[model samples]
Each structure stands twice: as structure tokens, then as C-alpha cells.
Target: MNFARTKEEQDRLEQIGELAVRFSERAGKIDEAGDFPYENMEDLKKAGYTTWTLDKEFGGKGISLYEFLLYQEKIAEGDGSTALAIGWHMGTMMDLSTRRPWNQNVWKEVVEKVKKGALINTAATEPQTGSPTRGGLPQTTAVFENGQWVINGRKTHTTLSPVLDFILVKAYIPQRKKVGIFLIPKETKGVSVEETWNTISMRGTGSHDLLLKDVRIDEKYFVETVDPVNNQSAGWLLHIPACYLGIAGAARNYALRFSTEYSPNSIEGTISDLPNIRHLIGQMELELLQARTFMYAIAEKWDRSESKVELQAALGAVKHVAVNASIRVVDAAMRIAGSKSLFFENPLQRYYRDIRAGLHNPPMDDAVIAMLAQKALDGIQN
Candidate 1:
């Protein structure tokens, strides 16, 4: 089922597939307990999977965007929570390496820690301001206190909070009227994680609330200012859709297997022989094909293209198509399962819930549509 075109890609995917098998074995248990997949993450770290996206100069493989998303989708098929949680760290590393927005010394320090199996995720979303993508100024504020920067605010949706080694917090500088990202090591004074993640979806992500009350850090930790709304397109964000697509793949596989095995006395063989079931299966395949084609094509294009700015609309389109298609694929799989999909013991129920989280992830559908509309209007006027 691995559609990798090259031998190297195939070999790498096989390795991830082995790890994913182990993760899949434990997925249901972790979901039932609603706990973070710490063991799965440890496995990734031990296998060097955690630093695969780092640049080659940083003592890592520096895999291409295509390779990254390919592995991400495979991992997600095994466990959506694990894939989604780790994708943030993986994508962040890729972005930092590509952008090199940090001071050279600071970037090297981060690379060293990441090479040593450290994890990171941005704490940007606030309860009041909602998604930082909406251009809402973060309520989180940082000020110069003596020689250090003191940051104070509570950030929600801080994924991987439990085991994060560093948190890149987005905060507003009231004195300067600018927004900047500050790197706060997990053990920094006054940095605390509140156990506030109690969602019914993607429960194992450990997306708790990050509380920073007068958190102190050196001035060097003030990484860079960001114009949230005007930030350039991020190819790394494709990981979000890739994760959901993998979940959809898992649901489709489950439905296929169930169809071939489940039979009733009234039927001749298995439910899979029925025309309606075949039609549903065909539709799911088509949906996956369309999404995967769009995702991989754009990812490969990103790897070769020099202009990410021009690809902004294309990137958003990929996420929009892939995510919506994944939802449809999962929903169809549920239809194939009928009422059994609702059972707690059925993994389809879990898949249903996990995939639903995609709708709320970054690059919200509304924004993407608006962007496309603006592009079309600009095109016509030109």
C-alpha cells in the first residue's frame, strides 16, 4: 500500500511501518485511558525519527516535504493522536531550519536539544483571541525586567505540553506594539502546565493549558517578531491534513476488512459482495486518491519550487481538499459499519472522533475559501 516511487523512500517507509505496527497495538488502550502516547514518542526518539526533518548540516537526514508527509500519514494510520501530536514538533523543526529566523547561536542550541530527543510546540492560541491565524493580538504579554524578559499569560491548546522540552510562546510587547515569539524552556521559573485537556477527540495529544506567570528568560530568548496574518505560507502545515488522511485510510482499511468477514444468514457470502457496499468502498478509494494526489503533488512542488509566497494559495487548497475528503472518507466508512460504528469498542467510533478534530485545525476552511476568492478576483481584474 506504500505508494513511494523510490527505493530509498520505500525503505524508509518500511521502517516507519514497523514502528507504526507497535503503536497501533497500543492505540486503543491509550485512547481508552485518554493518556498521552509517551511510549510511542520514546520509540520514535530512539529510532531517530524525531530529528529526521532537521537539516543535513544539523546531523539529521533533512528529508524533503514529500518524505515528511508520507511518513506522517503512515504514522497517523496507526494512531491519530500520536501522529497529530508529533507532527507539530516535526513541522516546527522543518520550518525553523528552512526559515532560520532565530539567532545563529540560539538556533544551534535548539538543534542540539532536538538532536538529543527534545520536543517543542508553539503556544499561540489563547482562549480570548482564539486562533492566532485570525490576526487577533495575543493577550500574552512580555516585558523587560532588569536584564531578562518576563512573560505572563495562559495559552490554551498547547499540544504536547506534558513532555515538551521547550515552548515557543507568542506574546505581545505592549511597550513596543509588536508580537514576538519567545523560547521558554520547560523548567523556566513560573512555567506550569494545567491539566485542562478533556476533549472527546484526539484525547491522547496532551494538549493542556500552558500557564506562564512572570516567566523569566534571557533577552536572547526573544526569538523573532511575527506579523501573524501576513506570515508567509508554511508547507509544513501540510502535516495537519496528512494526519487526518491517514486516519481516514485506517477507517477505510477497517471497513474493508469488516465487509469481507461479516456475513449474515440472509446473504450469500459477505457484505462486501453487496453492490451498495462496493459502491461505498469505491467512493472512499476515489476520495483518498484525490486527496493524496493533491497533497503529494503540492508537497513535491514545494520541495522543488523557490517561491513559497506564490504557492500560498495552493498550500491552503491542499489542506482544504485533503481535510474535507478525509472527513467524507471516514463518514462513509461509518455508513459501511452501520450502528456498530457507534460502539465504544469499535475503533471506527474512535476514528470518527479523531478525524473530526481536523475541521478545527489551522488554516480554517473559511479562511482558505476567502483566500481563494480573493485570488480569483485579483486574477479576473488583472
Candidate 2:
């Protein structure tokens, strides 16, 4: 669908690509250490990259959804965790600023923080509630007392919590009997980040547990989005699939290089000449192209269309195809590498592990399939 529709967008992509190359150089060390890529983030901030998604009126790039996805995929090529981690902040910021769901003045202040390289994310998930996407009430509670909302709960899977200057905490308000997203500053009293992230994949994300014990915040920070339930046309979530596609691309390239350069002593030519190796490479190319087309076309469509209707099934299906295709792409690459792909030192091993993380993201496969099935049934009935 050739979505890069403007020269300004094309130039922005080039600028971000340079930063991605620098991030690529440090991705391995950050992954090996299982720590946040502080230096990589510093470089990104210094380059004025944190303002990409904010509206142009706010002195930011105001990039469209299509441009954002393209850039995110490129960053994922350098480091999937960085791309995925920052996706929450970038996507959430863009969504909030564009829609203006809550307090406008509060958001303006948040934008200033974003421009200054202050990170942010919606801390919704908890150990007991699982993903908010599944539609369970949050365990975190918000109470009004003494001119402030007292927040008391622990949130898990809070990505980039360690570096976040602001957090949109989803908490249950008993008095209102509705969910509210409280904007809590990081330096607020009783707000602390717990070191609980210990996953084998996407280790640099720092998706640790966030503790908000009696954390107090001004009531103006609470925002209630329209149609909270069934509000499913989230273009920003495309970043997740874009990330997997990038990881798959990385694996595919590594396999192609290995096949081209490695020639066994017993064989006169490299594996690139072999029919089986060529077949796997071709398969990966086809899958990647197909998945990318689906992802990018939908993102571009979201930019042009004004419909607020929830394309729940369509949204989930895109993630399903892209992520599953990505796994296959990585598998094909691993098959080509054989035993060498399993070694801890090989980049292929890292890609393999990281790509799997996509499966665990929102829009779980089973729920997606059920939604698609119901859509078909509803269509038939109509």
C-alpha cells in the first residue's frame, strides 16, 4: 500500500533509522545484562526522538499511525525490547493527545515532560487481574481522602516502570463505581518500582512490578475514556506486531548471511547454493512480505477512515497472523542454522526467544479466534 505518503515522513524515518543503528550496537549487552538500556534511551532522548508522536501543534513530529508503525518496526530491528517498551509510551501518548479523552491542561503538562525525555506508560495489569484486555475489574483501588486520591495496589507487567516519570494507573473507584486512570507522578510519596521482572525474553523492557501503596495524587489526574468497553480500534497497538515482524526480519537476514558465507569443507560451495536452504529463505521472504502488507495497510487505513466502530476481530486477526508468521520465520531461520542456532552466543537464539514474547501480548490467540467466529455468525444472521 506504499504508506509513506509524504516527504516529511520519509525524512523522519531516515533520522530515526540512524538512531536505530546506534541502538543495535548496544542491544546485545543490554539483553545479556537483563537491565534497562539506559544509554540507548539517553541517546534517543538527546536526538529529540521522544517527541515523535506528539501533535505538531505541541511542537512534536505529529507523525501519522502509518509512519509510527514503520519507524517502530525499524527500531525493533535494532532492539525488540526497546521498540516494544517504548511503544507503550509512544502509542499511549499519541492516542491520548489525539483523542483528548481527559483533562486537556493535564495532558499539555504531560506533553512537556515527554518533550524533555520523561518516559510514561499505562500501568494497568496486575498479578491477580491479568490483562485488562480480558475485561476484569482492577484490584487497585483509589479512595478520596483529605483532598487527594489515595491509591493502594500493586501492578505487575508495568513496562519501563523504572524510567517512567509519569504513570497512568488504572484503579477501581468504589464511590464512583467505575474505573479511572489516575496520573501519578513517579516521585510521589509511596510510589516505588519493585524488581520483579525475570523473564527470559525481552529482558531489557524492565516490566517490573509497580508498588503504589497509599500513593496520593490530585483528582484532576483521573481520566475516563469514552466507551471504555468495546472501544477496540486501537491503531497504536500495531506496534506490537510491527515489532515481531522486525525480529523475524532480523532472523531471516541472519540465516541468509549464514547460508551465503558458510561453506563446509566437504562441500565445494556454500549452503546458499543448496535447494533446501534457498527454499527456506524464500519462504521467510514470502511470509514477511505478506504479514507486513497486512499490518501496514490496516495502520494506513486507520489514518484515513473516520469510523469509530470497533473492528475487534480485524484488530486481533492482524496481530495473530503477524505474530504466528513471525514465529515461523524464526523457526525457518533456526532450521537453516541447525544446532548453531541453539547456542547462547548466537543472535538467532536471542531473536528466537524475543519473537515468542509477541504471542503473550494482548489479543490472545484463543480470544481472537472466538471473536472472528462470532463476527462470522453475526454476519450470517444479518
Candidate 3:
């Protein structure tokens, strides 16, 4: 597939790149203070990047999946935490906007809010269950009564919850085996944010727990579920690889810069001139190039058609490759940097910590391995 960006896409990428540089400079401070990257989000809002995934009909740029991933990779390269936090909203919007079967009026309202700078986040992960990966249904239930639904449950790992204007929550409808997504306003009664996230990695993401006690919403706010097999939802899966690829690129860049500039009195020249250091940089660059190719290939395929099974497998592979590659590249950077890389004062340590979180993200290793095995078995059966 031709991965070249169009003129318009190229222009927008440059603009987002400038913003990302500014965001990266502040990422360290926010990570040190363990505070949310509020300034970075505000910059995204001003740039209208918050609505990049929304439909043009709904007052958005309506960029393609390929372009979206490219932009995400650029932003993530600057600051993985900010990219991870902002990606949830953008990816969610892209999924909701592109997927059909939604009520027209409700869709319109949600899109308008997004256009007006309302950030949306996924409130799915819970305290008891890390993520809905191992057959665990949501304890969060939305009871239908009096022509409305009352949602009551606590959600953990609610990324960007502090500044989110609205949240898309997945809740179980009582007596039904199905799960429904509800659009809940942040200011709704009984909805509160708990500051529970204090992790060594991605500390600036502000992924806290959400307390939704008796939060009521009209029936129209519920997003009906379609058949998982038939439904097309590639945008959500693609964002993970996009974010991780950017991080890998960042690691490569950091290593390159350090090798070129830092010199020891014991050495005749900078580390970049050394054969061993140059070889490591080349290896990291090769990994990034290959991972990015796979990532964009899957994205372009999604743009062309809705193939959930194939897309899911491809996305799983991409995430697996990109994230693991990122970790390796960061580790290589740290190894090359030596003892100084271990200090909190160095940005390399932050990158090292942030890249590891990708391993725990959805489309986990075990699941991906099983899925790949199933594909192999099916191939043999045919």
C-alpha cells in the first residue's frame, strides 16, 4: 500500500508536529508533579485536534484512518502519556462516528459537543477487574426504568477523566446478556472522579477511577450494539499501534541525539562515531521502520473495507510488534546512555517507564497469541 500522505494530510501533520513539540517540553514537568497534562490538552483543543475524528457533517475535519494514525504517531513521539490520554477520546470518537446503527439525533448531539471542545473517554475498566479481557462482565449496570436508564457503578483506569466533558460508559443491561454503551455527561448527578492513579509509568495520564452512582440518562443516550462479527470497529484497535510506534520513534530519536552530542574524555569522539553505538541506532531504526509499515498497512485496509476478523488479527499483530519494538528500542537507548539513564532527571528513564505500559494495554499477549493460533488451525482445517 502507498503510505504517502496527501498535500492536505501533510499540512495537518506539520501543524500537529509543532504542537507536539510544545506538548513534549511540558510532559516531564507534569510527570514529575504527577499532574494531568492539562496544558497539552488545552493546546489540542485550541488546534481543533479534539474533533479530528468526528464526521465533517458534525463539524469535524473527518480525516481518514491512515491520516489519523500518522498524526497520532507524531504526537505520541513527543509525549507518550499525553498521547495515551488524548488517544482514548479521539479513538472513541472515531469509532462512534464511523459505526452505524446509532440514533441520528443522539449522534448529532454528541458530535456537536465534540466540535465545541468536549472531550470523551471510555469508562470501562473497573477496580475488581483490570479490563474486560477474561470473561468478566461489567459490574456497572444500567437499569431501564421510567423511560430512562440509571447507571450505577465504579470504573477504574478512566483515562483523561479529570478534564473530560463526557464519557462513554459500557454497562450491563439487567437480565440481558448484552452490554450497552451509554453517553454520560460528566456533570451528571452521582458521578464523581477519584484520584487513585499513582503509577511509576504514564503518571501524567491521570487515569483515575470514576464513581457513577445512580447517574440517570435518557434512553436515546444508549448506543445499541450490533453483531460483533458484522460490526466494523477498526479505529479503536489501530490507535494502540499508532501510539506505540510514535513512542518507539521517540526512543530512536533520543538515542540518536545523545549518541551525537555526548562525549566522554576517555573517548576520542562522540558515541555516535563509535561502531557499537551506530549499530544499535541502526537496529532501532530498522525495527521502527518495519513496525510503522505494518501499522499503516492495517490502517489503510480498515479505510478500504470493514473486515472485523481480519482487522482484529492484523491490529493485534501490529500492537504486539509496535509495543514490543518500542520497549526494545527504549531499553537499547537506556543501555547506551549508561547509569545516567536510570535517574528521574533524565527523560530517557521516563520513556523507559512509559513504554512498558503498552505491554498491558488491550489486545494483550496471550489473547493475540491465541488468536494467531486459531488462525493457523483454521488454515489447516481448510
Give the CA lDDT, 0 to 100, for residue 13 in model 2.
75
lDDT of each: 0.94, 0.86, 0.83
Q: For model 2, give the 10-residue run with minimal summed lDDT.
A: 223-232
Give all TM-scores, in the order shown. Answer: 0.99, 0.96, 0.95
Per-candidate clashes, comma-separated: 0, 0, 0
Superposed by TM-score, candidate 1 places the C-alpha of residue 167 at a distance from the truth, in angstroms, of 0.6
Task: Give the C-alpha miss distance for residue 83 in model 1, angstroms.
Answer: 0.4
Which numbered prediction scores highest in lDDT against the true structure?
A: 1
- TM-score, cand. 1 vs. native: 0.99
Q: Of 1 and 3, which scores higher on lDDT?
A: 1
Q: Write the per-residue lDDT of candidate 3 for residues 1-382, one digit (tens) a residue.
A: 2245788888898899999899789878988989998889999999999998888877788888888888888899888888888888898888778765578887777777888888988788887766666546688998988998999999999999889988888888875667888888899888999999999988988899999988989888887752322334355667777887787777778778888899999898898898988788878877887888888877888788756556667778888988988888888888778888888888888888888899888878888789789988988999
Clashing pairs in 2: none
**How would you order the candidates by lDDT, starting with the best?**
1, 2, 3
The true-structure Cα RMSD of candidate 1 reads: 0.9
Q: For residues 1-382, what per-residue lDDT tens digits would candidate 1 score against the true structure?
A: 4569899999999899898889888999999998999999999999999999999999899999999999999999999999999999999999998889999999999999999999999999999999888899999999988999999999999999999999999999988999999999999989999999998899999999999999999999999999977858899999999999999999999999999998989999999999999999999999999899989999999999988788899899998998899999999999999999999899999999998899899889999999999999999999
What candidate 2 gets wrong by more than 4 Å, as runs, is 1-6, 225-231
